[model samples]
Target: MTTISALTVPDERVLHRHELLALGYTPRRITAAVRDGSLVRVRRDRYVRPGTDRAVAAAVRIGGHLTCVSALAVLDPEIFVFAHDHVHVHADRQASRLRGPGVSHKHWRKSEAGDVRLSRRRLTEPPASRHLLAVGDIVGQLVRCLPEREVIATLDSLLHRRIVDEPFLREVFRALPARYRRIAERLDARAESGTESLLRLLLVELGIPFEVQVRIAGVGRVDFVIGGFLIIECDSKAHHEGWEKQRSDRRRDMKAAARGYCTLRILAEDMFHHPEAVREALLGLMAGHPRA
Candidate 1:
């Protein structure tokens, strides 16, 4: 019973002091918990679980909630690449002496109970965590803070995860500038990963005719099929490990080659970190093939 209840606090990440009190934690119990290293005092009225993300607790301590890429990073890790290596916060305009680690950007809003932000990003009530911004608001921040491709990647992940559909995205974009509405059209939930989303945009920019998740006989679905016969597989480093998996992939490639398909394997890391090289390689590899 204790273990099960423990999970709720950790999962919720941060809670107000009154909420902790309502949960039957007296001042002494709360203090003891803090001393025992189970509860962290984020601020006078905010308490975070020991396992809570540092950024979340820091934001709360700074009289703000996590926002922009930082909040999304916590809400959905591995969905979108980091826009910056720092945390972004949404704090009260009246709050002062604001300083925290890794908090590069702090968005200010009028202080209100249960009303996190409205001045900028026009945040709805925080869906799950008070310490976190709403998804639509986070996307709004991403659109304002990051470049086009990065923002689209965030939108793609949001769709792929079914956190928000196309219509909801359209509605949110409609409230933003005219150019943002156009970005919603480029999002496709079929993208299985951020790297895939980025690569799709790259292909579109390069005017490459390719299909995603194409399945061939004797082999399972591949990431992309280009030039009609070339199979491009995007994989992360994890896929390269393990001999059994490697053998299975080799066998699949052999089967694909037997069926007159040329297989080209690309790592997700290359697509993310060395995009120019990947682009050059793709351009050179398809130099002989007619654009389909």
Candidate 2:
């Protein structure tokens, strides 16, 4: 079986030295493994799998847990729709030596309660890994750092993926500040993508009449069907990229058209990079298209 060992750690790729040593790998053998490219060194005492994610490695190298949306991205990249690229780290408040590339945000927990012993925030720091932070902690951090819509989008992803359930969400919400707790009500697991969740948030805020992932007899399941007649699809580049997918989508739109449904596909970039333009276009479309 393949094994990994590293003397130090800066990433998830690093394997534990103890695991190898316990497996009867002598120091000489470890060195031989390194020399033969069977093991790669991330730092002194840390050996890891060769093909681990770069951001994950960077966070571990920085002596911190990868966390927040950065952790979410590693865990389920498809669920990511918010515009955050930098690796986020959760580190010690007193760590003096924190230096690395790719880590733009670092988080250290603090207690707001007067007595530190009675603090609500977790004091425990789990083993640093490619994806660190508990689901509740991740949600809490998202509430603190991201905007309302973005947080809801992530929450929707967690819910849709069954990474979290209603009870878990309630517990998480109960711990949050009152103002933020209410946003939890807007989460809908029917959102299949971060972009879909984002669009749902817009529709919710605008009080638009719409249903998510509605299936029409002729057109199959759609991202959103608005006012019973308008079909809105939040197309991420991954979904609508090639000519094959585009051709398939056109066929679906053609099918929807036969049933008197108007389809409006929005590029995910437009939603992320040009929100106002997308909102205006949707508003114009809704105005012209009569409601069912």
Candidate number achieving the greatest TM-score relative to the actual structure: 1
* Candidate 2 C-alpha lDDT tens digits along 42-160: 55566656677775666555555556677677666656548675566665566655444333234322332111111124523344343355556656667776788888888887777
* Cα error, candidate 1, residue 186 (Å): 1.3
Q: In angstroms, how far off is 132's CA in candidate 1?
A: 0.9
User: What's the lDDT of the predicted structure labeled candidate 1?
Assistant: 0.72
Q: Write the per-residue lDDT of candidate 1 for residues 165-243, one digit (tens) a residue.
A: 7777776677688977778888989888777888899999999888998989888899899987889888777657788
Once fitted onto the true fold, the runs of candidate 2 whose alpha carbons sit more than 4 angstroms away are 1-14, 32-37, 41-44, 81-83, 93-131, 290-292
lDDT of each: 0.72, 0.69
- Clash pairs, model 1 backbone: none
Alpha-carbon TM-score of each model against the true structure: 0.83, 0.78
RMSD of 1: 6.5
